[model samples]
Target: MSGSALKPATELARGNSVRTPNESAEYRRAREQLLAEEIELRRHIERVAELRRALPPGGVVTKNYEFEGEGGKATLSDLFGNKQTLVIYSYMFGPAREQPCPMCTSFMGTWEGKLPDVEQRVAFVFVARSPIARLIAAKKARGWTQHRIYSDASGDYTRDYVSATDADAPGYNVFTRRDGSIRHFWAGEMGPSTADPGQDPRGAPDFDPLWTILDTTPEGRGKDWYPRLSY
Candidate 1:
């Protein structure tokens, strides 16, 4: 809605030239309607992103959370590197889990290819409660070469930002350092309570392209099916 030329989405759909061999008139009519909706959906996504960008400043980060990284000790501020903003993924690889959460793994795995492009603007880091060595092992196993990762060895950062208790879950948090002050930015706020009946809790504009890609297929992301570490 906000970006590029403001062409009428419905008009664009009406002018669509896509046609299949031997397609029925009824099918074309229905497809045109679907295309209109799809265009509207794209506009709606841009509108939501516009609103998200306009949000007022979020809470100030009060603590200097520590983490263990490849370069030894680091703090929340240190993660920002040269960028003004930092995006931290609180993955569910806490010490208690036998393996990292499959869902989280699936999500992070998708990010691997995009890291080079994404890190150009914001510093992206992956945080887990497991020790640095264990996390490094997992990263190597997964062939994740681009994203920076660290261990919330003390669980302080995890408890404050990820979850307060033992029910470890995956979370995405954004932080910004502006004018010598560090503050919280947007986060993926969608969760169980926001889910439609029979649908899993998921963020809008789905962070994982896996779900978005599946949504275009005949078989959508089923409610019960989920990613696994292994087949």
Candidate 2:
């Protein structure tokens, strides 16, 4: 659906209402105003998605990056399995960290259950700079049975795609295979440098329901609070 074909957000919002016990007329009016903005926000989100889907061809992948999975050595092309598109989430679980990043763990937790559904359309896997055994251990610790995790033990793939310096930062990258050639498709570009004042770096249309649910509360993703491995 195009934004131009839609009714004015304000006009649509005007017809919506929330009734509550003894709600004042002033409160109701303000609620309606907020509703209008929400409608506009929804439209804006769809517009951004449309723009992303329409992006031109991305750069072709030349490196035959290798990783270690459950079945041993595998190349980038192998990660795609039988699918044409692959989504790799490079988490901040490097050899140096005694434990995986709490934030990354939180993010992966949300996708653990949904991977089965998502894989029906695109091949999805989790990659980390740690050894294959370590990555598997973390998966077991989290009780994640559905996520396909791999180890970029050589750090070649991490340095080239996840981080230029091979830092232990989280990354989200997508690739596509066409005509027997692989190409980098999209990646999460927002990071610490792009974060707004008083907010942490986050992806647009954040895949984590944790933050989304927090956003609906009055606290609004509290300043210092973060997920813990065990709490």
Candidate 3:
């Protein structure tokens, strides 16, 4: 439904029966106001998703990018399996690094458990600019059983989608296969250039739940702090 056709968020927020012990009138008033803003934020998110879904056909992917999967050598089209859509996460694990980026590891960890549900709708896999053996070893070390890890050994796919220099950076790209033609659907384009003042560049609706959970606390996602491979 359009925003204009719906009731105002403030009016909807006023009908809540939420109450807390020892809460002052001022706190309740402020919370209710915040609730209205939150409702509006949710509506905006829905609108953005609608826009994304309405996009026209993306660029055709003519290059047959090669990758090494757990099974064996495969092409980009092979990653789609039986699904019409494919979601690939370019993991920041290059051959030059001893360990993968902690941030990427943390992000994938959040999705590990949810893959089964997500895969029901689309084929999802993780690709890295490292050897297949190393990628498999990292997956095993993390005790991840469901994540489909692959190696973009030649860096062709990485250079085209993730980074031009084939740098170790996290990338989220979506592709669609329709009528025997594969095309780039969408990708997370937000980066250093898109970052706001005093904040790191992040995907819209923020894919990471860690930051969302921390945002509710007084100590939120502070500067100078990041995830680590191990404690």
Candidate 4:
């Protein structure tokens, strides 16, 4: 071994292998090694999250945007709801589309069950360009009872945070409301330019459990497959 070489973390892992009838020594060794890597990967994810939290406060939100929800009009400040941090997911459901983007719907569906736990630390909501009634109907149809959907009827917020021309796109924007002022915190900036070959444009440490789960299978997430609204 080279003088500079270090042992892989597998040596330090306490993970054990299953005693399945067909399991082999080689399989145990490989799994134990992967366990060590998984441990390190988890730590790495937290470190990246910490770094993201440490970023200097992002741009100050100058526009006092208003949106329509189930109860009527609500300004950006109203969305903050008692929490200092607010996360708004700009969904890709433009007024012109007969249906919302399947990808965005899939993403939103993932968060439905987790919203209650997530909101304990941060306020969260979904925004789309569709009318309030349309957005509400879709949410109900999807059986998403936890989240509140809103409409950027004027496309003002969508244009400002997502696309300059009001293109149908998905955006993850975070903001901070403090001392009577609100400021942008961060947004998922990864896009086509940052995409690796054969992969879609996605942020590091992909938050989607669906993709993560599919990645563990032999078929993997094929290039053409995507979530559907029905069946």
The TM-score leader among the candidates is 3
lDDT of 4 by residue, 1-231 (tens): 231354455655654534567888897777787888886787677778888889987889999899999999999999989999999999888889999888888988898879999999999999999999999888888888998889999999999999999999899999998788799998999999999998888887887889999989989989999888889
Model 2 scores a C-alpha lDDT of: 0.92
lDDT of 3: 0.94
Model 4 Cα shift for residue 164 (angstroms): 1.3
How does model 2 score by TM-score? 0.97
Residue 19 CA error for candidate 1 (Å)?
1.5
Measured over all alpha carbons after superposition, the RMSD of each candidate to the real structure, in angstroms, is: 1.8, 1.1, 0.7, 3.8
TM-score of 4: 0.91
Per-residue lDDT of 15-82 in model 3, one digit per residue for the tens? 98999999999999999999999999999999999999989999999899999999999999999999
Residues 100-201, model 2: lDDT tens digits? 999999999998779999999999999999999999999999999999999999999899888999999888999999999999989999989999998888
Number of the candidate with higher lDDT, 2 or 4:
2
Deviating ranges (above 4 Å) for candidate 1: 1-7
Indicate whether candidate 1 or candidate 2 has the larger TM-score.
2
Model 3 lDDT at residue 196? 94
Summing lDDT over every window of 10 consecutive residues in candidate 3, give the lowest-scoring window. Answer: 1-10
Error of 3 at 56 (Å): 1.2
Two-way lDDT contest, 1 vs 3, winner: 3
